[model samples]
Target chain A: MSTTTEAPQVKETTKTVDFKTIIDIKDMDLYYGTYHALKKVNLTIPEKAVTAFIGPSGCGKSTLLRTLNRMNDMIPNTRIEGLVDIAGTDIYSNEVDVETLRKKVGMVFQQANPFPKSIYDNVAYGPRLHGIKNKAQLDEIVEQSLKQAALWNEVKDFLKRSAFSLSGGQQQRLCIARALAVNPEILLMDEATSALDPISTLKIEELTQELKNKYTIVMVTHNMHQAARISDQTVFFLNGEVVEFDQTDKLFSNPSDKRTEDYITGRFG
Target chain B: MNNLFQDANRQQISGRRRNDLIWRILFLGATLFGIVALSALIITIVTDGIARLNPDLFTNYPSRRASASGMKSAIVGSLYMLCLMAPISFVLGVGAAIYLEEYAPKNRFTRLIQLNISTLAGVPSIVYGILGLAIFVRTFGLERSLLSGALTMTLLVLPIIIVASQEAIRAVPRARRDASFALGATKWQTVSRSVLPSAISAIMTGVILALSRAIGETAPLIIIGAATYVAFLPESLFDTFTVMPIQIYNWIARPQEAFQDLAASGIIVLMIMLVIMNVAAIMLRNKYQKNI
Candidate 1:
């Protein structure tokens, strides 16, 4: 029965796309203890594009995003099965170091989780860990990362002040700057701006648009308008299955699935 | 209908007033009970121990002559004990607390260890005295030396230090831990840089409080065979020793008025030391809390 349903769908999806895949996921199933959180799923995240995962809460979009960086390995009794290839390297292989993977694929969380340190120190932390020790070099990296995150102007005067002293939006930007300082190739954001007010959300979305030019971005957002506005590609997920994967403009305008159309039209999630 | 409503409202107001009176009475009664108990303790200590305060109390060594003897030897002995015990106990206890609180897995063994430490904290000081006697004095053949006494005191107060340090470490939020780890820090790096700094103030406060308790402990020292009379101060860890509590106990046991006055002076000294330690702990805790 499983083979009967999966054969045609595999054939249908393969025929439509030919993109340079940065991350190739195949037959991935995830479980939180005994509860099946993510069903057998396959996806190909394209290189140098803003790919957004839009789904309701508990739809496994964030879980899937974390899998790209092996962040799910930290959780106890969480099991993952299948192949996840990052740049033709199987990230799940025994030889792959999670630390190196995490360094290459940076993550930003739902809330702004800045270190309880000065703003300069927060940005310099990642670089310092990778053995960049010269003070002048660290300072240069901090400035460039902050500027890239669009937070340099506001925090330039108070680089020595505690990161906790910043406003919410500034703190979020500081967190982004911290991730960028490590010079990762890919950035995964899990509801990165959901905790912020609408203005901050808009700012983060604008920053996301600018960031895709340098780093491949895979973002999980509940905001449909956000997915429509910022993402170059959109993958709609439901019940741990991909409802539709298409260009953001095409998915929002002409959703082929009834569920995707209903979701985009503000029906039940 | 309006008249009925007004009558009900009047009843409700009177009922609330009666309830408030009852609550106020209960609260005042509880406050008075606590005050009376505290006053009784202070009065007993002051009346019994104050008269002993005199110049001779710090001048002469312990002797049979109640009028002439002092606790100079015992004071030296206790100072020596503090010098030996404070650093060793603080390091071991705080290290154990940090390991248990931050690194230990939530397994049955860790839970058992936690429960055992808490139970040890509540155990009578005399039991620790007995343990010290068996382990340090008899088994090791240290034989009523200052080292044995200090080791015993260290054991007696260790649980308190561990509990205090754990509370301090726990007060640091998990968000701090996540932030540190997210910056590519290893577990040890995260704990050392972020968690320990935030927890240091609380840990120091706990150590100071534990040391105060250790200084006041008489039962454990006595059980471990602390001398009541020593002619000279202990010059080494192995030298025979006496502490402030032992000296006071010796003086109070005598049936002479002059000796009782000496005991009161010793009590005054001990109380002053305790107050100073407590004030220092509070100041350190506040300073660190503000910095964090």
Candidate 2:
């Protein structure tokens, strides 16, 4: 598809070789009342790789990301058609409890919305929701989740401190730890670091790199460079349609679609 | 002309300052008007009733002799009624708020119900008294006992607590609920653990204010037949009761000047009870806010 232009750069992406598909979305269409938000979308996400969805504002990348965990169901009058099969089961089916689905597919929001609680309680909130009430077990999960989110060192000493006491960056990471505390199979991040400063963004990107080794990560980002730096696969979306989905370096260096090239190169979004 | 703020007309600025001073004084006067009125009332009551503030006020029952009469029965009865009415109103009101805010879907029916509740909060307390008369006193055969009067007071204040609780619950940021729900907490869990905890202090403040209004109420209890000159304290829910307001009202109606002075002493007692309730609520609010 990039027949005319010579490829400029290729970052090594050798790890995508053994990726096993864990999420298969087919013929998926999402509608909010009268307006169709996502149309005829098909995607297969690897089990333990960071797949970033990149698009302009209102381009349905975030909409698609929300559909992955049915977070969009919170919106009234929303409808979904076709299949979103996670680990070989349709998440939208009647038998699938929405709460359990959310527990398994944890999410971190754009704004770091930690509960008005202690740092330990914010992390332990998830485990307690699933009925893990033993103090020792909760303490261990809190420690492990905070460590996984790279926030243990900053907050471990003051575990009883209010979550709002943390700086914005630390709070965002605390939210990440909160999501990870549930021990989810997939972590959906909807512009999770966009609210933070550049240094915090880098920290979250680095955290994502380490986190993808264990959990399948789906992230929606307005920052193309963030997608390039952290994602193994990049899905470029335009007007609710998948314009191009490919390995991150391949798409950035030599996009098959002209629109993808324009958006990535900052010619126009 | 080069400086965009060129020559701001010093004379005009001075004139504006004079006008601003007038408005400032006006607002200050408006604020002081309320304080002055209240202070004058307290001064009058204190000067009139200071002699009645002796140990005799606590121990003596109502008597034909003005100096010997005390509010012992009224105080005990009022306290007992508050203790009875408070729990019932709090549970019903807060429960109604939780249902409307968390569980009930927003629809025309719920909007109508909410509208009615708001209107009920503004309706005269006398109307609630009448309702209590027809229902609790007559239909239920409870008569004009403390239970009937307490239930009427509950009815009078229930709308207030519900409205205030709804406001408190609504004031909680939606993000907090979202945070809880995202962690796989059920709707009830989210509301109880997250939403309620954040709103409890504000809700308590509202409850205290509502109860304060209930405590000062005279007409509802009067309509429910609170005996104005009870010699013995109310012993049970079904026992005849007379509250402080009714006691004070009865004294004020007497032609005797000493009885009027006694009424002022009763007024002081009522005000003290109110101040205590408000102070306790503020302390609880501060404690809870700092606890988090």
Candidate 3:
């Protein structure tokens, strides 16, 4: 069901906007040692929307996601140039605390990487780190986040059980709950559901939809169908460059670039 | 064609015969050598030492006369030395290992430290003895006391402890660290809360094995001047000490036939202690392996 039509250019209009841009990345370049992983890239992520980055492996989708939270700073010989501003503050600025920036910008990995701890402890870890000491407060957050993840029912009885003892799908949802418990304004997910079965993937996709009402989400996924099914805005990346970015409907049904069209149709990676 | 076929068959038969004969000889020779060596050592020790084994060996203190003597003093002294040495060595070694494995950046200095530790592990026991004599005994004024010997032995096996502990800590999968960090824990928090607990058994195994090695060391204690004929048990860390190996050495060095018997008995005791330590290490290692 391919449809090719030019996106209608908007006429000049003026209105008062209430929402703010949560993340503003401009001219961002990332290098692993001497290899340029992400060429100069730029994007503005709006608040409270599911923004999906779709690309083949090694195209720098994950790199861009990591840079949003300064997670790449952990790797030795990894260097970034250009600006990544979150909430009007440059995350790369010398005065900004990396831990505080990370606290506000939570991340989930490709694999379900729950800590080798109790489910309750795993969910409570983030809040505890940011100096939440009240037992009642942490308990409330853990229960609320788990419920939001649609995992509270399955795991509530076994809250004290090890996170590792959960099923793969359960573990992934637990990780999501953990990220949510911290109350981050922006959530960065790097192929969060790529390792789960289709049923679990659907659950996470649904949860992502529910979460976007409160938190802005930027996810990297290789699955085109997943991007189309879950995301509001889709950015198609190829060879460390943004090939096409539009509404999900437009990007999938009426891709403007030949490369995006080919990738979407499974003609080539 | 007939000639070629015959020649091929003959060569094949000869090669097969040679191969079979060589394989048979090698297998039989290895088995025979292993059995002979093990039996000879066991029989020699048991036959010579079994006569000295008695209840008093564990109950009474050492004496000048063989008929009145027991290994109680040496046993107590060895236990006390282990008590002091194990904790000291474990703390120093594990701390060094954690710094090297988790925090220390890869640089020329760390590389040099790592290399030096490996080389030190290979240094002869006697050299450690001399160093202990010159340093702990003289400079520290420990005066050939149990503390001096323990300190010397600690240095002797410190490298082994560090190496083993490093391996254990490194064995903890990187995913654990990533998980902890993603949860917003700091580096030390990640290590102490997650990595160290998972690696505890492996670290313990290393510590116990090193301690076992230290317990059996005779040269260092002898060089540090452990007394041979102490009638009283050591009352303090500064008191002169004699370990099982040193006592056994003293016994074996005597011309009296009875003293040689005492040496054999001491060998049995030392062997039993070593076996117990090794078994504990193996158990700890297995427990962690199952969990991880």
Q: Which candidate is the best by TM-score?
A: 2
lDDT: the better of candidates 1 and 2: 2
Off by over 4 Å in 2: A1-14, B1-8
For model 2, residues A150-238, the per-residue Cα lDDT tens digits are 99999889999999899999999999999999999999999999899999999999999899989999999999889998899999999
What lDDT tens digits, residue by residue, belong to model 2 across residues B1-292?
6586786787999999999999999999999999999999999999998878887887889998997899999999889989998899999999999999988888999999999999999999999989999999999999989999999999999999999999999999988887888778888999988999999999999999999999999998888788998999887789998989999999999999999999999899899999999999999899989977
Residue A261, candidate 2: C-alpha displacement in angstroms: 1.7
Residue-wise lDDT of candidate 3 within A1-269, one digit each (tens)? 22353332221011103335788888888899999988878887778888999988988888888888777878889988898888888889998887777778888888998876789988998898778989999999999999988999999999988888899999999988988888888888999998999899999998998998899999999998989988878998888887778778888999999999999999988
Top candidate (lDDT)? 2
Evaluating just chain A, the predictions reach TM-scores of 0.91, 0.94, 0.91
**Predictions in order: lDDT:** 0.87, 0.92, 0.87
Candidate 3 per-residue lDDT over residues B35-118, each given as its tens digit: 999889878889988887889888877787888889888999999999999999999999999999999988899999999999
Q: Per-residue error at B203 for model 3, in Å?
A: 1.3
Query: In candidate 3, which residue ranges exceed 4 Å CA deviation?
Result: A1-19, A131-138, B1-36, B289-292
Candidate 3 interface RMSD, angstroms, 1 decimal: 2.1
